[model samples]
Target: MSPSMPDTPTPPLALSPPDLRPWRDGGSGVDHVHVRDSGRPGPTVMLQALTHGNELCGAIALDWLLRQQVRPLRGRLVLAFANMAAFERFDPNSPYASRCVDEDLNRVWDDAVLHGPRDSVELRRARALRPFIDAADVLLDLHSMQEAGAPPLAICGMTDKSLPLARALGQPATMLVDTGHAAGLRLIDRGGFADSASPRQALLIECGAHWEAISAELAIDVSLRFLRHLGVVDADWAESHLRCPLPERQRLLRVGEGIAARSQAFRFVMPTHHLMVIPRAGTLLAEDDGHRFFTPHDDCVLVMPSRRAGEAGQTMVRLGRYED
Candidate 1:
């Protein structure tokens, strides 16, 4: 049996989708992608937004930068609005329906999928954006969550290099270390970005709840910090726009497993919050049909518990543990 949809009404939309018509004919051959080059030699830092159309904070951040005329001081600054086809369909009345037009754009980054004959609205755009993504020496993919009021998270892809960069950024307060989903590879884990020996690094920030007013604020702050950290933008300008104070330290959570729902009956014992830590090893977290989920170890962290009803094979939540 299919799961029943949640009875709760969607939250009020607090963010206005920025007007992107001005960026349609960007300098980059690909539509909706803008590139700025500095004559001096430096790394190409790419700031990508709109990976998921429903996530508006990223687009807001990039739009703010463009309006401010922020450009690289030494390197190339690539500001890309990815998955614009999906973004174009964004409707405030049914926001989540437009996360992607077909398959998730973030999951199609693997070469096999990119090279294969399989087609999607998302796949085609990913292909067009691939060359620029490949050229980037540093990348920051802006994203947000479905759960309201959740704290911001830095999804540091599975590499030794990313954790340190997240540590250096120093906000967001929590960082998650995990491999890409079984569904497919994420853009952050694609190519040299995932290779420990490669200098290419990427960080995907889940700024806050999708459609929340604060999410846009956090996105812009993080974008400035990222540019400032890499010396891509002038220090004075970056500092001028940065509104958030740095967190004293950021905590790391290494995800051990992603729990996929096996049946429509899957449900948590109680409400779950993002980054909520279960204190006991055997405490019940959720149930699916007849099976129950328990914390694997003491103080297991629940990462991004699904706000919607779970469908079979959908990842409901990820379980992780804090690193000392």
Candidate 2:
């Protein structure tokens, strides 16, 4: 049942947060433009959501924030929901349905691609909002994994600038992956995902899997914690948002084959949902017809399945309780 299921006491939708509606800005396909003291002139914090069009978990929290009274104690708070095309195309009980219309929105942070005349609808949206991201003091881009077992984690992407902030989010186990923060290959990695974004920085928090009720709530919780981090909100809420993080050091298991292999052989493996653990020297996924075998050489948390259906290599993230 959905969290909004009729039976769950629907926590009296409070009018405490801000409200966004028409959800369309003059048919430009810009879903609701909500501003809470935008010009109050303090450090600007941008929380961009639903960039993928399919991930609507943030939408609920966005709605809650809209309905609630957000009194940012410090800098200004700006909330934006992308992909109006997908939002309009939504079907009930299937929020995280469309990843993108043509290409992934989160993968286009590069201004050149964003501004290029050849950009697709997704890229166009990315371009339209460049100024906001460029000027913000901080950016908390919320996202959820597709698999089931992968614990909620924050991606630092090896950016020296974003490392400390990642650590601060309190996920405990932080992985320092190598990727550029500017190319926009992924929504969060570019410029080494380590840029010293002076007066600004970004953190990508994987709340939960697709359509998971807690995903939206955790998105909201993290946003509140971010405000606290910026000194824009009270410390109490931040404290509440903090989760007992995992460990300092972690191991990133490699997905040698990628998604193509999984599609043909793996069965019943959900990558975006974050599930399955491939024990070292253990059978990760047995190929149908018994022609091939998938196994892990080291003990690790199998992250995202590289293969579409293959239950082998992919999002395999093994965390350590101790720092190596």
Candidate 3:
């Protein structure tokens, strides 16, 4: 069992869980796969939500898109609500418990992991969804953070192709380049999306805190921009629904390494949030069991500090640096 850490109050659930019943029997021959084809030649763009069941912002955005009758003007548009089994278990009082049913859906995208004989609720879903994902020319996977007050982020793989796609979305202020977790590959990093030479591109957006009302709005804004950028929807239609101005500029952060919990006693020296930069090298970040972890370099940025203290071998936070 995980040791108990400090008791922090759970944030009020500002957004209601989306009723995904209407999308369950999607026309794409797969559950939750809503595909719209313009019959014109263009790239097939996919927008996926609910990668993590606890993250409701993306689900809300996808719900709104359906209500608004949003469609494609070019090739094809796929709006997918993933991890339904996990999502169905979401409870306002215990929101975090529903992040997954058996395993994280986002982490089972590797070819080896997907093709392996291993069976789980999430892996089964991933296998079923892999065909649609493999057919997509571009994918935008929506997500949200664990910590409150953390700004929105565009998580891209370490490739030039995806960086520009994140920049093109232009709502989120920070674009983080990463190789993904050591435990497994993410949906965005699967197949051609991981290849720098491949024209296929994917970007994962961390809209904001999991249940915040504003996170839903941010998801809608970015989703609209993604559609507009791909010509799936016209600029007028997308811009009309935008509730806020776009960021003047976006900053890029290159993740250097993740600080994994070395033991069950891991604890941060201080409270941390995403994009918090430590000013000097060797600054104490955390202590785990008998070991101490310090910043390796000056101006080290911490990404997504874990709320679950003492979760052995799990990533506590990622350390990164700004890119010029």
Find the candidate with the highest lDDT and give its number.
1
How would you encode candidate 1's per-residue C-alpha lDDT over 129-198 as one tens digit per residue?
Answer: 9999999999999998877898899998886679888887887899988866888899999999999889
TM-score of each: 0.96, 0.70, 0.96
* Residue pair clashes in candidate 3: none
* Best by the TM-score measure: 1
- Identify the runs in model 2 with alpha carbons over 4 angstroms from their true place: 1-31, 35-42, 93-96, 148-150, 171-184, 190-199, 237-297, 306-324
Per residue, candidate 3 scores C-alpha lDDT tens digits across 198-315 of: 9999999999888888899999999999999998898998989997577889999988778888776888888777788999999999998889999999999988887666457878
Which is better, 1 or 3, measured by TM-score? 1
Segments of candidate 1 deviating more than 4 angstroms: 1-8
What order do candidates take by TM-score, descending? 1, 3, 2
The candidate, 1 or 3, that scores higher on lDDT is: 1
Model 1 CA lDDT for position 38:
88
